[model samples]
Target: MKEWFERERAVHIQFYRRQPVVFVKGEGCYLYDVEGKKYLDMVAGIAAATLGHCHPKFIARVSEQLKKLVHVSNLYYTTPQIELAEKLREITGMDRFFFCNSGAEAVEASLKIARKATGRKKFVAFSGSFHGRTMGALSVTWKEKFRRPFEPLVQPVEFAEFNSVEDLEKKVDEETAAVILEPVQGEAGVYPATKEFINELFRLRDEYNFLVIFDEVQTGFGRTGRWFAKEHYGVKPDIMAMAKAMGSGFPIGGVGVSEEVAEKLEAGEHASTFGGNPLACVASLATIEIIEEEKLVENSEKTGKYLRKRLEELDGIKEVRGMGLMIGAKVENAPGMVSRSLEKGLLVNATSENALRFVPPLIAGREEIDFAVDILSSLK
Candidate 1:
């Protein structure tokens, strides 16, 4: 397997730091490697598979869609695409949405829409926010390491302190086209935005006429115990970029836009070739239905609380933060601890130098939570 991986690396780009395991199959909250060793999945493909691997409904729907149709460009309308868009509209209460192939593309679309609609060039983004790696999204992302190498990026981005209403007020001016933030900062250790801060953003948006964009790429689709993370604060964003669990394993993303913002986007302004194809659209629709019918949003709230409570009781932990199944715990030697957990048949992620992230599937139960906690407590 190592030889095979090395061979593949020769041909593919070295973009990802992959694990040593070669997974061959997945079902529910578990994955099986090539050797047939079963492991509990806590990361849920980095929170992309909300319903867990190969969900029966997800598979059936995608397989059926495959037989019927797959790729028909935006020039033509497909039923699955329209249905999925309507479902998104109902969930977000937004007038329209533009589909894409990944979270980065969604973020890119939101940035373009904000600039086009408001006719402003500057954007205000919070520190520790991870929008995406694309040029437009990367400009707003706060990490110096990711941004330094990609110099001469989209310019005139101002950084504000996360959860600091005062700093936000100071930075956002009339020239600001948009303010982009993750309601729950996933890569920055699952930090959720304070209600007070969110309220202030809405106030600023109304006062300055700049759009407020929520980068829900990682927190959407019941990851935060709600339909959308912004819902927790009772605030609506002018544009919302979402992907991750929306398609349950398929590469699909979308930007929900209010009627006002949608009106500014003229035809031939922004487009994706393979975006919103039938396969991805059907998979997304099925994933949404399964999340609703199974009541996974409520489950995320209940299970996540239980998991956080248990983690808090453990020794050698500094902080436990986040909502629903999206959780992060600060611990020593985070990366080493993650590797140890993998050895014990558990899959988790280290989002930072000291933060261990747990974003299991929405269908996770008490047993899985207990098993994961036991592994963490036993880690040295």
Candidate 2:
């Protein structure tokens, strides 16, 4: 494992602060390092691996699709793509779908669609929000570290205080094309938008004619125990960008648009080569089916409440925020906690300097939750 790490450092880009533990295999809610040390997975690949690693159903479905078809041009039609769209419409209430490869690409498509649909230039976003790393997504994302190196991005993007109606009202107007936000801000420590905030945004949208785009990349696909975060607010967005758990870590994402926005799009305005391919679509379809068949969403809700309750009782925690399995606990030293937790055979990450984030797989049960809480409790 040490030799493999050395070889990787020699060739691979050092963008991410790579962890020392080199995991070689994962199953259910656990991962095994190259040295055969087993660790309980709590991050779930940054909330992307929905079904956990090597889910039997997900693997079988993808393998079946691979045997039949794999890649083709977007110019041609595919059954899996259309079928996935139908399933999403039933869940999300969106009329149209555009496939992509990641959350960043989905946000890019949403930005383009909003700009073209509304014929406006400026956009409105909130503080502590994280859309993605792409240029357009980054423009709306509020973070000095991520934006400092890449200044002069998409122009005229205004940042409002998260869940502040007054600031949102002041920023949104006739010139605004769209307002992009995460219903639950995951990257900046799981800060969820208030009901009043979402209501006011919709009211302003009607008056100003600007679209609303929900960046549900982390909060979607039952991560928040609701299928999508918008359900908690009971408000529908004009455009919704999603990825992460969509394909259970199969590198697939998509943008869901209202019929009005769909009609505004012209041919050749946007496309992707590997987006919505047969294999990716089948993977997503199988994921959705398994989640429903297994009742994982309900499990997430039940287990998440138990986890939050346990965290609230911990002396080290200051506050607990977020819904379902996507949770963040305020700690005095998040980095220290993560490091200590890792040494004790647990996998968690620090979303911010003092906020520890947890987005375990939907399949995680009470036993795993109990074990995880014991590790965290012991650390405290």
Candidate 3:
């Protein structure tokens, strides 16, 4: 294994600083390394696997689709693409959609729609919100580490304090094309926006007429145990950027826009070559069906409550905060705790140096949650 890593390092461009073990295969909630050791997958590819790894239905659909047809240009439409779009529209109630290959592309499309519809140059983005990595998306993303190197690049984006109505009001002006935010901030430690904050955005939208955009890449697709996190708050956004789990690990993403906003973009205004390809669209359709048919959203809610209840009872936990499956716990030495949990064959992400973010598979069961808690208890 070391020899294989050395060989790959010698030839390949170094991207991620990966762990020592090479994952060989996965089943449901568990992954096996090359050495045959199994680990419980809490991260779920950053919450992309809506139904868990190698879900029978998911695999069967993708496998069958692959045998039929894979790709054709966007100039021609495919059955899967049309069906997927209709399904998404039915679920989100968004008037129209623009398909894309990934989250960043979806975000880029949202930015274009916002700018074109409002005829405004500047955009108001919240601090600690992660849109994506592309230039347009990165401009709105407000993280120095991700933005510093690409300075003087994408333009006309301003940052505001998340959940601070005063800061939002101060930052947003007539020149602001859109106000983009995550209904629940994911990468910044799973902090949800306050009811007051959401109401403030709606107020701003009504007063300013600036488009409202929800970066629902993480908070969508039942990750928060809700179809979209915004539904919990009862606020509707003009545009919603969706991806991550949209295709259940297949590279697919889309932007949902209101009827008013959707009409602004003409045919030639935007396009993607592989946007609504057959394979990805089929994957997405399969993913959504599995989520609904299996009632995974309800499972997420039940398991989330059970897990949160157990976690909140832990002695060393400072606080447990989140909705449904998107949970974060503040504790002393969170990074160390994560490391210890990894040693015990469980995986989770550290949101802060001291906050543990748990986005386990929506289908994760009672046994899995109990096992996770067992590992967490040992950390204390």
The C-alpha TM-scores of every prediction are: 0.98, 0.99, 0.97
What tens digits encode model 3's per-residue C-alpha lDDT throughout 187-253? 8888999999999889988988899999999888888878889889887799999998898888899
* Residue-level lDDT tens digits of model 1 in 1-380: 78769887999989988888899899999999988899999999899999999888889989999999999899999999999999999988778999999999999999999989999999999899998899998999999999999989998999999999999999999999999999999999999999999999999899999999999999999998998898899988999999999999799999999998988889999999999999999999999999999999999999999999999999988999999999999998889988999999999999988999999999999999999889878887
lDDT of each: 0.93, 0.93, 0.88
RMSD of each: 0.9, 0.9, 1.3
Q: Name the regions of candidate 2 deviating beyond 4 angstroms.
A: none
Clashes of each: 0, 0, 0
Q: Per-residue CA lDDT of candidate 2, range 1-380, in tens?
A: 88988999999898888767898899999999988999999999999999999999999999999999998879899999999999999988889999999999999999999999999999999899888888988898899789879998998999999999999989988999999999999999999999999999999999999999999999999998899999999999999999999999899999999999999999999999999999999999999999999998888899899889988998889999999999999999999999999999999989878999999989998898889889998995
TM-score of 3: 0.97
Pairs of colliding residues, candidate 3: none
**lDDT, candidate 1, residue 123?**
93
